[model samples]
Target chain A: MKCARCLEDTAAKVADAPDGSGAWEIYLCSRCNYSWRTTEEEEVINPEKRDPYFTLDGVDMDDLMVLVPVPPLKK
Target chain B: MGCMPACKFKPLNNKRKNQGVNNLYRDLREFLAKLEEEGQLVRYTDEILPEPDVRHICRASGDMPNGPAVLMNNIKGYKGKRLVVNVHGSWANHALSFGMDKDTSPKEQFHELCNRWDNYPGEVKFVDNAPCQEVVIKDDINLFDLLPLYRINPYDGGYYFGKGNVISQDPDEPDNLDKENVGIYRMQVQGKDIIGMQALAFHDISIQLAKVEAENKPLPVAIALGVDPVLSFIASTPIYYDQSEYKFAAALNGIPQELTKAVTSNINVPAGAEFVLEGEIIPRQRFPEGPFGEFPGSYSGIRKQVRIKVKAITHRKDPIFENLYIGRPWTEADFLLGLNTCVPLYRQLKETMPEVEAVNALYQHGLTAIIATGNRFGGYAKSVAMRVASTPHGISYCKNIILVDDDVDPFDLMQVMWALSTRVRADKDVIVIPHTPGMPLDPASEPPGMGNKLIIDATSPAPPDSVMREVRMVDRMPQALEVEKIIAELQKSAGK
Candidate 1:
């Protein structure tokens, strides 16, 4: 399945209902880290139904990533 | 505008003096019971989808006048699970949290909270056992199974624990009670046992993490969920770095806060909390987190934040999961942080400037603050505004400071707009200082954490700075107070 936010096909099934009920499944995108459950609304799970404003298509993931520099270890 | 009569004010409901009951709730369930008894909570037992339905109800509650806190019991795919939202979403609920009359106005609540804040460093009672440890999961810890996790906003990257009272201590001063910090930060459930926490550079947790990371040691933490209402409020408050939040909670409630040691760490969490997830922040590790809707009404961009590996989960039987819905302006996030935000700024300003009357930092967590103060001299209002920008929370959040005459009620936006319309002269009243420290979540910040700060002095001219000609101000009629009292009596008799 494709990620709803970034349209990436790297989404993978992460977990099922702990009850082993096959009631719902959670999927996480390896590319953008977006996670959603199968029971979510179409707007959240379906890429086509996603809001364009939140879509990360054509945007560089590196540009959006904020890497806070780790402070140096004490000597 | 003419000021109202002083007779309109109602006597504060001082529970401590009248009934000897200080609004100290032992647990979230006790508070929820009080909310239900007072007609401030709505419960749903119908089976509802986890997504959209829960959030839509919560979002709609913010639009109602003093909306009720929503409790959902029967969520699809999750059996015997309970979730609550908007627990502190309205002024009425906020007042009720303090055991005050539900009709208490925001201005009155502010004064009551300030009065309680004066009695700082209250007592804390340590305990050997707590209800939060009734059910402990040491192995096969899965957050998805433990929590009824659901996304608040459609664009949010993952389900977040938005209201957990995260307890941690300074690694260097591990035994110092004062150095222990209990704060609330957005925690994203990244995996079954992995969580990503947004620990901003300025956050107290970040300071503790730095000390541990420098030595390549994991920082133990306890994220307490469904805590007492007052504990949540005190956790969100920006107090001194060394001040203990449990003590603050004690002071706010006029009683000793009860705390218990975490299962795996020395951190003390509220003994009455419903759940406590014991974990440790992996040293020098970062994980992709966020794109979550923040209190600023904007989605904070994804960032590589500190990662935590959950080792255990302890909870009361059938624990209730509490989460906050933050989207746009005036959600539960606003009400939760509103008056607590104002009291701090008011105290800081009143310390040096006695003429400072009131502070309303309810908007976007004091990104913009409206301060009412009596001017001591010309440009004194501007000086007060500058001081606001330097306060602990203000350093990063107070980007726009609006100053008004002491008579103006800063809590009332209409009164504020009147001052802005009549008192402001663009050329002289506006002061802009660029390239100042700001909150990164602010969408307007250029470099994320840096931006311009603005101060608008709306007070009338004092001695030595008369920009406009003196005009006689209109005053209320002498009989206005008597007439208002008569009308109030008539309305009461008519059941209006």
Candidate 2:
């Protein structure tokens, strides 16, 4: 399977799923160095992302939020 | 009305360095600009409620890598004013506030903090004119009508200054920083002219108040809000009674803190503060204070504490209101206290066992820790672990101590868990201390200030080469890179 993030085909089985039924697979792109969990549909579809002000509580977002800079104080 | 010209020290270079930061920013605004420069500050324009939305944003951003401090400019009721929260919520931000690179590790940060403690000298220089005095209101003032103090939680007693750092001095020695006490105490707005302050019986401020009360004198205080981040961290730290936080702040900022007299009291306040509440806590009076959310993720039930009778309110023309929210594990309070708390414990352990590599405080109020050290003897691990569990004030509150070998990274949760699983024997490694000094906010403490402690020696007992649990290591180039390439291929094969 191809990586969802970088559209690369470097996917492999990382571990067995918690129920031992579905195997957990991960896709890592060498170009951008982005890693995605293939077994978890959320990380693939709606991966945790930072908002300008808030991230939904209880969700661990991977990216740090970027803030707009205000005018600096002078000496 | 303004700062003295002589105290205006030049701002230091912003370049990343190893020896620590040189100069403190001029004021809170300049400090916020520095956080913005480092990409550690975030702004929210959403018209949020006063209760949970603003607090939720702080918790979410505060739990991240170098915690992005949140600035909420669009509150439901307050339009022209801004509320800055979680400003010191990340490890990287903590280092940045004190003049270190944003990438400095906890161990290196600790070393720099200690070095500042050793060599930095602090002085409090008075100024004549200050911004905090730009607008003074002494009469016909109602707190609810004048300021936008939010009720963060449902069961909170009332609106509060969650991040107000109180500055008080010994009545006898009112001018010296040595007798000055600065601490972050929760202030519940009890009325238009009064606020209930919780100075826990164990705090130095409480001790100072007790001394003043014996002589039947009101302890004068100045509550400072929206000061620079470095001073805020210093106030939140569990500085020893004899050590002055103001001096330490000056040292960290590389200049003397500009002080100005409060309108209602003689106590000196940071001249650059956005706002200052001048008041006095009467000697024998007590008022109902809390039922407010505490740092330990629980409500500190109602108790009668000291009451501050606000006599004057002074602030900058267009002041920004600053706050810190309690409750939950990884909020700003935890990060602020965690960074400073480790320094004291390190000093305590290093006095005898200089082999201690580093200490990592975990969760709210540092209730648990992972200590890295060299196991010199079979029982040396337990002995050091005992000191970690029993040390007074800040770290003594750390009830769970996990001792690991020097090779293990204390900040890595998985590595700590692995050490616990492999090196620790349930019966042999666990040592329980029955009764010890405790944190009042801990929900599990039996008598509120007393609790049991557990020390797990996670260090290996086997010889260097002989290991009980076999471990497999992965190489970086072919094995890891090939896995990444495989995952990329898999994602590509899967539909868009």
TM-score winner? 1
Backbone-clash count (model 1): 0
Per-residue lDDT over A4-47 for candidate 2, one digit per residue giving the tens place of the 0 to 100 score: 33344543332222223342333333222233333233432232
Give each prediction's DockQ, rounded to 2 decimals.
Answer: 0.56, 0.01
At residue B340, candidate 1 shows an lDDT of 86
Positional deviation of B345 in candidate 2, in angstroms? Answer: 1.4
Residues B186-244 of candidate 1 have per-residue lDDT tens digits of 89988788888888888888889888888889999999999888899989998889998
For model 2 chain B, the run of ten residues with the poorest summed lDDT: B1-10
Q: What interface-residue Cα RMSD does candidate 1 give after superposition?
A: 2.1
TM-score of each: 0.94, 0.75
Candidate 2: segments with Cα more than 4 A from true spot: A1-75, B1-20, B63-67, B103-108, B394-396, B461-496
Error of 1 at B417 (Å): 1.8
What CAPRI grade goes to candidate 1? medium
TM-score, model 1 to reference: 0.94
Candidate 2 residue-wise lDDT at A55: 16
* lDDT of each candidate versus the true structure: 0.85, 0.70
